[model samples]
Target chain A: MNLVANFGPGRPRVEQRRRRGQTPRAEILDAAGELFTTNGYANTSTRVVADAVGIRQASLYHHFAAKDDILDALLVETIAAPLELAERLRDVREPTPARLYALAWFDVRQLCAARWNLGALYLLPELRTERFAAFRLRRDELRGHYETLAAAVLAEAGGAGIVGAAALPFRLVEMVINMRSDEGSAPVFAERTIPEAALRVLGWPGDLDALRGRAQLLLAQLEPA
Target chain B: MNLVANFGPGRPRVEQRRRRGQTPRAEILDAAGELFTTNGYANTSTRVVADAVGIRQASLYHHFAAKDDILDALLVETIAAPLELAERLRDVREPTPARLYALAWFDVRQLCAARWNLGALYLLPELRTERFAAFRLRRDELRGHYETLAAAVLAEAGGAGIVGAAALPFRLVEMVINMRSDEGSAPVFAERTIPEAALRVLGWPGDLDALRGRAQLLLAQLEPA
Candidate 1:
């Protein structure tokens, strides 16, 4: 059911992905993601997205039947990779805190990767509508992933079972939405620090710096494929 | 210069501040804050706010010259209080961590206090307009207060100065924007825990439980007035 499995920055053969002009469908979705981020979902119509892509408005319908479908594709593009990481982390065996760090690290990386801070769109009130139900479902699945991992981390650390603790750390990972760091510092800072901050929040008793280095290494190891 | 200096929950006789229907202006602001939170700033016209208060739309202009004026009032009402607390915190001579905790604790209380979570309205795109510029400036001042305190805590604790550490904990304190815990548990949980979590993120070296109790007392001391 999860179409985004193995989809993300580390995907093999990243260069083979379509160039903007070479593939009209991918180009259209690219334009839509940009428009939705700038003008918002309600203000961005299919015609605007088509024009932005230098494609005819009529042809936009061939690739996506409706405007909401384009929005769905945008949401899926931004979210699916995080969901995939969560899906992997939720079922990980013992030493789950380390695995959770990997998930959080990967998630924080995605939040900062995009040229635009697309995660800000997550706060739009319109996303609550019935039309975005699929996106909502996937987002909830992501929440479940965070919550499952949080409960285990709290339990293992012998911390009080604070309801909604998962949310704070998950929000920390999602901090990239509002975060504005100097361009040079962002990648190193996020990779080096976010998991440490989250682990401290979780009362993780292990060496935080050591754990962060390991998480970085885990992601880096998967990078060279 | 700080219009919000005499703001927040600590001020004596908060109940004596206004009585319902005592003045049309107060009634109008209460209505506007509610309408803005529900229907959103852009969608809710002056007429709608007037109708909500059972006043003729033309009469609304008498109290506030423009719709954005009403929006400014609502923003001031919700935000002035926290800025006041931050203003107070920034000047405390010593035990700066303790002061920071007080500011954060009071802020968290304000976030959970209202019948509706007016803080969520801060995310609306309309708030970015030039109309709310003054409000935005004051909001940034409050952020500065938080950042100043965070820098002190990090420095005292000998933690590495990450580029945006101030923002993470600040956003952590602002977590009430999205938090929807069970109604009965909301106050006790937020009042009891958010400061501790934020301190943990800030790497505060002090005993957390003692600091939380102190923050509670500092706020409680102001309550009987």
Candidate 2:
């Protein structure tokens, strides 16, 4: 079965330091990230990860204490960056519509920028494992961020409390995570498209241009001063 | 790792026929479905499936030529049901709004009624295997069904053409597939909930009560008369 192909016999080869600037640790993370996305976290093994990175299995551990540590490093960049952005946007002066726009705008841009469908990792039931607990907490907090913003948009639109209202925009933006592999859309358009559709889903009847503009303004403030 | 824990070992046992009247074939399917949902399909083996059904491993082959066939059967009921309903809706006399509502209403209901999250199987990369080719075709056709309806909704909404329109509603209804286990929301409410949210996502500004009523009326004709 292709399921067990990762376990094939080998004394894994070591890398020759092919990349100019990246540390071996970073390279291991890159290779593991690709395999984890393609072969699945469950089906892939330490040996398979070593083989993919062109490193000896023993050398792989020198960088990561374990497989999950590599996964955690990825989460720090992939999942945590947006959480930081969401935290910053919560303090903005504009009302709910602008806050929701900013969140979806950058969030979709991040998803489009990722090298693989990271949502595949998010969907795995194996994520409930204790190894991923830290990542899970940040992920849940990001979810809470969306819910708070979505709730405001609903209320702003006079759309009153509704089941899954908070969840609607979150799922809409998450559609980016699940989009087809060959998707050729520009991230610029996706920034506007998803959050705007989200406003529609919230029954928001505000000016789209104004809301999108606020998101861009807010995005600028998020960068280093 | 808990990742592979689903593939347990067992000698197997015989069923007592706990239910009043399920045939052995039907019983095997029920057990396999439960295990597949509880455990990843790649992690589940013939022995584990047989033990779940209280049957000998050799006996499982009598009913299902192999494990994938059992999976194929579940797809027929869980995924194929919506496809069939969409086919029936195609022949009905209604606007695209009513047709999309009919599709989502029944689809969300069928999802809530199913005992397991079958969409998890649909997400597996292994689904691209040759055996699943037929299922993939039907699944793609269902996607086409959503895009056509979504395009009409977007045109009606005066919304600009952009990224991810067709995927928005499919992912929205598929949220039912990803909902948390503790969720006890009324399915009766979901019948209205998902479709209406989808119209909002499509930016449909039509009177919802009237549209929902028409969807319900068209739903009656979907029965195999």
Candidate 3:
């Protein structure tokens, strides 16, 4: 069960007037984010968030229209950091496939773990309602950004001829992220397993020490050539 | 929610005498399997399965102790076919990595789609219970078989030194199977995508037609000298 699945919907909603210098909205969002992460989206209720903040549920509603609104806010904040990193990596001059692959993989891993649903909610259609469309669109946009970054890098690295090879890095990264989401295993298992698997796919020497050094070398190679 | 979740310790047990001439047990299982596939495991109940077989719920209970037993039976039947196939494939003399990988990919795809709950059930903790441990153990055994097949093929192909290379084919196949389990996409998409992805990881051309011919050629290359 996901953290979101544990919280039942329906919380008391009492509006609270903000003081001249305070941001009650931010407080409500902060509480919701913690609950969603620790508990789960499904199991969390607005009342829980309000109670955590020592505010009425109505005040929480005043800050956000629904529980999904809280989720949307969390997603935007959570996903934005990695999306920014991906964007910065895309701007690197003469990017090599290996370098770009590593950057994107690392970025997605960081973002996936930070989000409570681990990005599955964005991909799951049953969860994709009109309210959640913005989150989905943002997620898709980030995906496209990563794909474009990969394509550019593959082209630079002389591996462009392989059909879907450019997109393989992104797909592999997503696969690793999904594997980490499995309840049976610890994230450490994936952390060890995925990079080795990915390095092999990228045609690197799969030795961890070699991979780390070679990844650095590949990044250096991508510098303004 | 799973059928197993609906069954608790408080439920009453009833003993029944078995009649050799009447195979009500098998009939109920057959009906339940069909209903579970079409209506989903959560939506289908013991009563529903009983109705399909023209029997009362009590008679259904006479065959299987609970709905979870029905699920366990279905899983055992579902997973056994694929394990058998893997064993048969493992016995093929002089298998190449490409041939072994392709065959494994095709076999896993077929099995993943055939058992509607196999992937989803893996996500459920109830399926990991002691009573259902056989299902998981069988799955692990099958995975070990595939890994061995891949390692043997890689060793024969003289590419064992590629650094994590020995583990690549198995990881690729596993990733593809995981993707196929996602409810959003069609099985055909994964079937096509995974093999091509596997070929690329194996350092083969990614074109599907090219892969088919190349896999055969690679197998021939691995034949005993």
Going through the candidates in order, what is chain B's TM-score?
A: 0.81, 0.83, 0.62
Write out the backbone clash pairs for model 1.
Answer: none
The number of clashing residue pairs in model 3 is 19
Model 3's DockQ score:
0.14
Candidate 1: which stretches are off by over 4 Å? A1-22, A92-94, A160-164, A180-188, A220-225, B1-23, B160-164, B181-188, B221-225
- The window of 10 residues in a row where model 2 chain B has the poorest summed lDDT is B1-10
TM-score of chain A of each: 0.80, 0.82, 0.63
Q: Deviation in angstroms for A58 in model 1?
A: 2.9
Instruction: Tell how far residue A80 is off in model 2, in angstroms.
Output: 0.6
lDDT of each residue in A63-152, candidate 3, tens digit only: 788887777876676567656655656665533544554564455456455534344333322234677667768766766776675565
Q: Chain B TM-score of model 3, please? A: 0.62
TM-score, predicted candidate 3 vs. hidden true structure: 0.60
- Predicted complexes: DockQ each: 0.23, 0.35, 0.14
Model 2 chain A: lowest-lDDT 10 consecutive positions: A1-10
Q: For each of the candidates, what fraction of the native contacts does it recover?
A: 0.20, 0.24, 0.08
Best by DockQ: 2
Q: In model 2, which regions exceed 4 Å deviation?
A: A1-21, A160-163, A181-189, A223-225, B1-14, B18-21, B158-164, B181-190, B223-225
